[model samples]
Target chain A: MRHYEDIAVGERVELGSYTVTKAEIREFAEQYDPQPIHVDEAAARESVYGGLIASGWHTAAVCMRLLSEGFLNETASMGSPGLDELRWLAPVRPGDTLSASVEILDTRPSESREDRGYVKNRLVGRNQEGDDVISWEATNIIGRRP
Target chain B: MRHYEDIAVGERVELGSYTVTKAEIREFAEQYDPQPIHVDEAAARESVYGGLIASGWHTAAVCMRLLSEGFLNETASMGSPGLDELRWLAPVRPGDTLSASVEILDTRPSESREDRGYVKNRLVGRNQEGDDVISWEATNIIGRRP
Candidate 1:
């Protein structure tokens, strides 16, 4: 398994893409968000966005899926403390394909724990039209090589 | 509808609680996070957490549901730009009931737009034992009264 020692600062990895669907957007929104712009197409059209849009949380979850498939699955990931910041730069609409990527910004071995370290990365998702849809800086705990 | 003019800084609101289920935790993990500690009981038992736990995103989404039901539904919420910071303070496991709340921290009228303004709030979720499970600072766009 890829460990903390195996990764370095400045490394960038391309995560796979996901296409948002109208049905999935509505389903997720119905459960967690339920805002008019996310769940009701007609109301969304009358609102500021001018069309139905996916919930920001849904977009973040999609990016997490890509991160798991492309990077975290291969590593000895312990878990994450949380994110430093998150910005929904642009609206994610139905049928928009979002391609995601992560760039390692920094890595530091734990002072109190020898078995694990922290890896900081910047994650960004861009739509089919090349506009950034979401971005965040996250820190993950990765186990050291045994 | 409640508008930007209706809310005041330092206002605190209690969002309702939610009991997380094992099935729901695994479902969200399998779809998005899929981390072993979050999805597989056996694997999680061998991991540091020693048991299955909910994905951080799932916990955030649950909090979003409470926020929407308790507060956003009553206001002229346009949408959120995003959050400033998020920290998962403690692990969330199956059967854990989390109660959420939000306190308005600041508000600013948009310089370029008379139709809307920004509301900044601190959101927090505490488990049954009163331990904070997650917290974040988020900013939302709220429409002005017509």
Candidate 2:
């Protein structure tokens, strides 16, 4: 597993892509969001989005899945404190394949703990057409090399 | 349904509550996060949290469910543009009941659209002991009264 000292600022890692399906969108929204625009296709067609669109939270979860598969699983990742500047730039429609990536912005050792550090990164997900669908800044704790 | 003109700045609304179960926590984590601390009880017991904790995203989604049930369903909510300042203040453990609320911070008519406006608010979720677990600021589009 990659440790804190193994990662560098300015390094960009490509998280694997995910193609969102209509069934999955409805399933997620039904349990979490339950908004008409997200769950009911007939109602969504008359709404601003003109059709069913994935909930912003669902889109975020999808990005998280990709991040876990491509990056976090291979790192000495402790966990994340939180995120900032979460923006849903565009609607994610069904069948839209989203590609995600993260750029390491900074890395700092914990002032109180020598065994771990914080790594800040910018995460972005783009649709097949290259339009940004979601983006955020996240801070994660990573263990150091022993 | 409540329109943009019906909402005012500084109005605070209680968004009901939800009790998270251990099964649900692991289920959510299995699909989206799947981190050891969130998924495996044994591994989580040895981690900093000392037990399995719900994924931050899961906590956020629980908040969403409450928000949808208590607030958005009654409003002329067109959609949301985005959000900012998302913070996970504390770990959400199994069987923890979370209560959520939203305080309207500001309201403004759209500069270009006469039919809609923007409502900005702060959303907060607290555990049974009154400790904040998650909070964020969100902006939603609301339709004006005809």
Candidate 3:
């Protein structure tokens, strides 16, 4: 398993991809962000978006899924204390394929805890056209290997 | 519908609440977080947390849901450009009831767009014990009444 020591600053990793679907978008919106632009096609058409758009929360969650599957499982991850910033730069629509990429921005061992280190990662989710739909800076706590 | 002029800085509003459930936590984790501490009960018990914890993303989404139900439905919101910060200060467990509160931090007319304004709000989600589980600063674009 990759430990805190195994990661390096500026190292980039390809996280995985997910295809957004109309049904899933509506389902997610219905449960978590039931905005008309996210849940109703007709209403979305009349909104500023001019079409249904996946909730930003849904896109962010998809990025988390990709990250978990791609790296967290193989690492000594200790979860996160928080996110620094998050933005929805563009809209994600049904049938759009989104991919994630992560870059290690910085790392430092915790002074209060000897067993873990903190890593800052910049995560970006791009649409099929390579346009960024979501971007965030996440800080994760990782266990150090003995 | 409430417009940009309707919200005042420092105004606090009750967003709403949601009760966490075991099945819902697992289901959300399976789709978007899949970390052992989030998805598998036994593994979570063996982890540092000593019990299953809901994914922070799930908690954030619940906060979004509450915000939508509380105010978005009655407001001329044009969606958000981004969030300044998000933190999961405490663990959320099954059967734990969560609630949200929103305080408008700032508001200004859009410089480039006369039709809309920008609003900054601090959203906090607390558990049954009144401990904050999730908190964030959100900036939303709101339409101005004609």
Candidate 4:
């Protein structure tokens, strides 16, 4: 598992790929979002989205999945202070294939800690067409393994 | 129900405040986020967050609830293209009273369809201390009944 000591500026990681599905979107929406455009295809067709669309929250949750499978599970992450920015440029459709990439932008030791540091990472998601679907820079405090 | 024929620029909506509880945090974390720092107080005490903390996703979800109760339920909004930006500035903890405010920043109609327009909103969430916890800008495609 990677630790604070292992994170370095300029490090890059590819998080492979993910595909969006109508079932998943509908399920998530039914449980949490519950918007007409997210749940009912016919209602969505009559609505402004032009068609069924995924909830923005669902998109963010999908992003977290990528983070977990690609980085968090393999790291010494304590937790993040917060996100600096998150933008969803395009709709994540049921047929879209999304891939992710992350770059370590910076790292520093915590002022109050000798074994922990904060790392800033720029995470980006793109569709198969290479168009950026979402982007965020997150700051996480991590501990160095003794 | 709010329909598409109404809404003015500069509208400000006050979503009712909600009091966060530890049980709610734990339930949300267990089902949705489930990271150690968010789920286990003891583990969080040993981690960087220092205590059980709400997930960023949880904050966004709560924000959605406010929108539904305050604006979406009263507006003719169809859906959004997507979020322009999302920022989590602070941690929201149990016992915090979270309130949200949404301001209509801009409104414009489709050149070909005067009956339909889009609105951009700036939304901010604040805790009991009045500290901003999260902020976001989103685009919503609203309708104007002819």
Tell me, by lDDT, which candidate is best: 1
lDDT of 4 by residue, B58-124 (tens): 8887887688667875676666666645777888888788999999888788788776787889889
Model 2 chain A: ten consecutive residues of lowest lDDT = A65-74
2 or 3, greater by lDDT: 3
lDDT, residue A37, model 2: 92
TM-score of chain A of 1: 0.99
**Residue A99 shift from truth in candidate 3, angstroms:** 0.2
How many Å off is the CA of B142 in candidate 4? 2.9
Q: How good is the docking of model 3, by CAPRI class?
A: high
Question: B77-125, model 1: which lDDT tens digit per residue?
Answer: 9999989779999999999999999999999999999999999999999
DockQ-wise, the better of 2 and 4 is: 2
lDDT of 4 by residue, A7-117 (tens): 889999998777888998887777557778788899888875578888878777777767766887688877666675677778777878888888999998889878889
lDDT of each: 0.96, 0.94, 0.94, 0.79
Clashes of each: 0, 0, 0, 3
TM-score, chain B, each candidate:
0.99, 0.98, 0.98, 0.90
Runs off by more than 4 Å, candidate 1: none
- Rank all candidate structures by their DockQ, best first, as comma-separated numbers: 3, 1, 2, 4
10 residues in a row with least lDDT, candidate 4 chain A: A79-88
Stretches of candidate 2 exceeding 4 Å from the true structure: none
What is the TM-score, restricted to chain A, for candidate 3? 0.98
